[model samples]
Target: MSPQLLSLVTLWAAAALYAIAMVAWSIRLSRVADERIQARQGAGAASSTTAEAAAPAKERVAVGGGDDAAVAAMASGATSFVVDDGDETDLPRRSGADRALGAARAAMYSGLLLHLVGLIARGLDSGHVPWSNMYEYTITGSFVAVAVFGIVQARRDWTFLGAGVTGFATIALGIGLTVLYAESTGLRPALQSFWLVIHVAIAIISTGVFIVAAVATTLQLLQYERTDGERELTGGAIRRLGIRVRNGLARWTQRATWFEAIPSAQKLEAVAFRLNAVGFVLWTFTVMAGAVWAEHAWGRYWGWDPKEVWSFVIWVLYAAYLHARTTQGWLGRRSAWLSIAAFVALIMNFTVVNLFFQGLHTYA
Candidate 1:
């Protein structure tokens, strides 16, 4: 078979593997949620029982002239009436969810490997940079998102993000295969420079990082919005609709316990900020490299091409976001919103600018 066909087959196989991994993570998340619910109920029952037993034990000690050890024994189910001061006990048995999570993680790694193989095949087939069009961009971008998630997972047990990252990759690859698929072809005259490798590769990497940060920020927003549960607010139709929308989102989020497995809103916001910071720095270099390449290719360093203009807008917005997060007291929802808006702009730059806007960077 030809290299392009082989790459296509491998890419689809990778997408399927990603879909399976997503399912495994989803099952693990559901089991974890159930365990949390049961633990909460058990804790409530134990606390109530302890409170009742402590009351009578205190009365008994006061009337019969015994020590506090008797009260502790009464509450602790120790029939020997002895006080155990140490907190150590038998280790708690492991749950099935741990094993399931392990399986899910293994699946993700396998899928990631397959995804890389496909990208390599594509590069071999194309005989140039694989990310020369929307289809290639989506494939490479999705791969980077998964790769970043895997790197983060290596440092921390963020298996909770597995479902989201895999699901996003599956969807992106599906779109690339179905909607954005283009036959392997030669590059345009403007794209023939070596900067194509440096500029577009950095841009794709930054976009992928932004995608991961966007996922974190979105979850953070959903968590923040549901912090206090549903509330009845008095307002006009538009205001009420907004409230309804939030409530609806809260209801949808409740369907999966995976969101509960993530870190707190504060931590998630910090994660998003840090990731966006790295993305912003890389994006800055992408713009700089693009300018240098434009000078080489078009004999001008600064032209207000649609792509250049949007890239600048994205850079400025993220710069403001980082500044607000560091200097001003902007964090949590504010920083998250800023990050989301900037990601939206990045998407628009990729889609709207490439397809609709007339510019020097209209290779797509």
Candidate 2:
């Protein structure tokens, strides 16, 4: 068979691996939901076994204590806590759902394997890096998203965000494979430069981060179901896990309190802000590099091409978001919405410019 077709087969294999990983993460999070809540409720610990309001903590969990007190304490409050670290296998097993999370971690690693093979196959077939088309972007962005999740998890306590982000990555890549797939080809004369590698690589990485931030931000909007008129932990760390949860539109503003058990609203906000900051910096570089390439190839840097205009619009939207957060009192949901808006602009530029605008940057 042809090498390109072989590459496509491998790509599908990678996507299947990713789907399994998502399921594993879901189970893992549900199993350890109580542990997550306990870890967050150190000094001001809450009992899933109580009938009180939500309590915020100044620090995380205390290590090597009597696990029974914590566990028994949470059975009534609707959100339970796991005090004992299960099976002393990994790091300070701070939560009850460690086993499931461990399984999720295994799935993430497996997905990474498939993603790498798929990307390598595409690159081998093309005889160059594979970030030159919509299909390539979808695939490459996915790999980067999972890779970034692993990297970020190693650095922080935000591994819960991985499942959603990688899930979206898989969906995007799958869409590309079925709806936007094409045979591999060489890079354009204009695209055959270091700038392509540098600019697009940054864009891919930033977009992956965008995927994570967007999911975490959206999760904030979720509401917990009540049992007997009291707020309860609906499904471990995920407040709304049931398939029938009402995610109606118009209420785009989400609260960080919903995730107070998973990651502090402050931490989630910081992660989102940091990701946006990095994406904005790279986007600035992307636009500037495009200008230089445009001047060399199309004879003018600021020619108001559709690609250029959309890129600038993205830059401006993000810039406005940053300004609003810093100058105005926009934090939490407002900032999250703006980040989503910026991504929408990015997708628009990537899509409309390539598909409809028909300009110098319309090679894809």
Candidate 3:
């Protein structure tokens, strides 16, 4: 088979693997949720027993029948109640859940490897970079996202994000293969320069990181919404309906229990913040590099092109998000919303602007 055909086949295989990984990760998450629920129930039962035993001692102390030593002993015993550290290594293993997690991770790695092979084949066929068009860009972007996730997972157990990452990869690959497939072609004159390698490559990497950050922020927002409690709705019927729908979804998520397997809102926020910070730095360089390349190619540093405008808009949104998060103390749900808004703008810049809007950067 031709390199292009091989690349296509491998890409399809990668997508299939990612889909399998998503399912396995989801199963593992469900199992984890069940374990967390049971642990909470056990802790609750233990706490109730302790409270019952302490009631008489509390009454004796209140009646001045308990000596200082007795009160001290009760306090010491109360303090001795140890919180579970969540370490399950010593407990009997659930082989099915462990296998699911292991299988998910293995699939992720295998899919990523196949994705790399496909990209390499594409690059060989195109005789340049593999990301010169929308189809290639989509595939490459998803690959980078998964690569970033893998890199982070190596240092910490970020398996909670496995389902989201694989799900996104599968969807992106499906879109690339179906809607945006393109023949291997030589680069346009404007894209022939080395600047295309530097500018667009950095943009792709930053966008990938931003995708992961968006997922983290989305989780943070969901967890925060569930924990934030209910609020009265005061609006028109349509607006109230929307609010009611949102509240219903939050309530359903609260019942899912798998959400408990995810990190707390605070930790998710921190992870999102770090990811966004890295993405922002890379994106800042992307914009700067794009300007330098534009000056070299078009004899101008800045233009009011639709692509350039949207890129700048994305940069501004993320900049604002970071500034608000760091300086203005917009930490929890507010910061997550802002991060998500910036990500939405980034997606629009890539999809809507590229397809619908005309610009000098309309190579796709």
Candidate 4:
């Protein structure tokens, strides 16, 4: 078979592995949730029994004098408790969950290796960089996203993110293969310079990082919403209906119990913030490199092209998100929503602007 065919086959295989990883991660999460729920129920029962046995001692203390002592006794006897959602070390590990998590890690590593192989084959077949067009860009971007996730997972058990990352990579590869597939062709005149390598490659990496950051931010938002009390719906019928639907979905997700295993909203927010910071730095370089490349190729530094405009918009959105988070103390749901919006703009810049809008950057 040709190198191109080999590349395509390997990419498909990688996507299949990613799908398996997603399923395995999901299974692990389900098992963890079940264990947590059972543990909580047992704790609740034990607490109730202890409180019942202590009721007469508490009454004796109350009647015997020392009002402050009575208050302390009552406080100690209170049954309400808060689970330490951020730490899983205290929880009993289940063999099934461990096996599922192990399977997920194995699948992710295998998929990443296959993905690397596919990219190498694509580069060989194209006789140049592998990300010169939409299809190649999607595949390369997804690979970078998964690679970054893997690197982070190595240092920390970020298996909670595995399902999201792998599921996204699989879907993205599917979309690239089906909707954006293109024949291997020589680069356009404008894309022949080394600047193409620097600018587009950085752009792809930054985009991938942004994708992972978006996923983290999204989870943070969900976790924050779950922990925070429900908002009151006050509006017309249609608006109220929408709110009801949203609240219903939130309630359903709350029942999953897996949220207890993942890190708290604060931790997830920190991870997202750090990822976005790195992505923003890379994206800053990408925009600058693009302008430099454009000056060399088109004899101008900044044209009001659709691509340039959208890229600048994305940069501004992320810049605002970071600035607000750091200086204005928009730390929780607010920052998460802003980060999510910025990612949405980035997606639009990649897909809508590339396909529908006409500009100098229309080479794709």
Q: Using TM-score as the measure, which candidate wins? A: 3
Candidate 3 — which residues are off by over 4 angstroms? 46-95
Question: lDDT tens string, model 1, 159-254?
Answer: 667788899999999999999999888889888889989998999999888988888888889888667567686699999998888888877777
Candidate 2 lDDT over residue span 1-364, tens digit each: 5657667877787777677777776665555554555566742554452434344333344557645456445533434455547764443544435666676777677768767877878888898888998889888988888888888888888876866876886788689899988788888898888877777887787777777767776654332211112233366545654322343221221322223335555566777788778778877887887788777776887998787788889999999988999899898667777878987887887776788877777775
CA-lDDT, candidates in order: 0.85, 0.71, 0.88, 0.87
The candidate with the higher TM-score, 1 or 3, is: 3
lDDT of 4 at 193: 94
TM-score of each: 0.86, 0.73, 0.86, 0.85
Cα deviation of 157 in candidate 4 (Å)?
A: 2.2
Off-target runs (Cα >4 Å) in candidate 2 are 1-6, 34-96, 223-261
- lDDT per residue (tens digit) for residues 1-364 in model 4: 8899999999999999999999999899888888888889978887778857565543423333345544555556644333333444455545888999899999999999999999999999999999999999999999999999999988987778888999999999999999999989998988899997899999999998898888888788778667754557989999999778768767856876777777888899998999999999999999999899889989998999999999999999999999999999988878898999999999998899999999887876
Over 277-314, each residue of candidate 3 has an lDDT whose tens digit, in order, gives: 99999999999999999899999999899999989999
> Candidate 1 or 2, higher lDDT?
1
Model 1 residue 313 CA deviation (Å) reads 0.9
C-alpha lDDT (0 to 100) for residue 228 of candidate 1? 51
Q: Please give the distance, in angstroms, between residue 52's alpha carbon in candidate 1 and its true position after superposition.
A: 11
Candidate 4: misplaced stretches above 4 Å? 45-94, 229-232
**Alpha carbon deviation, residue 184, candidate 2 (Å):** 1.2
Candidate 2 weakest lDDT stretch, 10 residues: 223-232
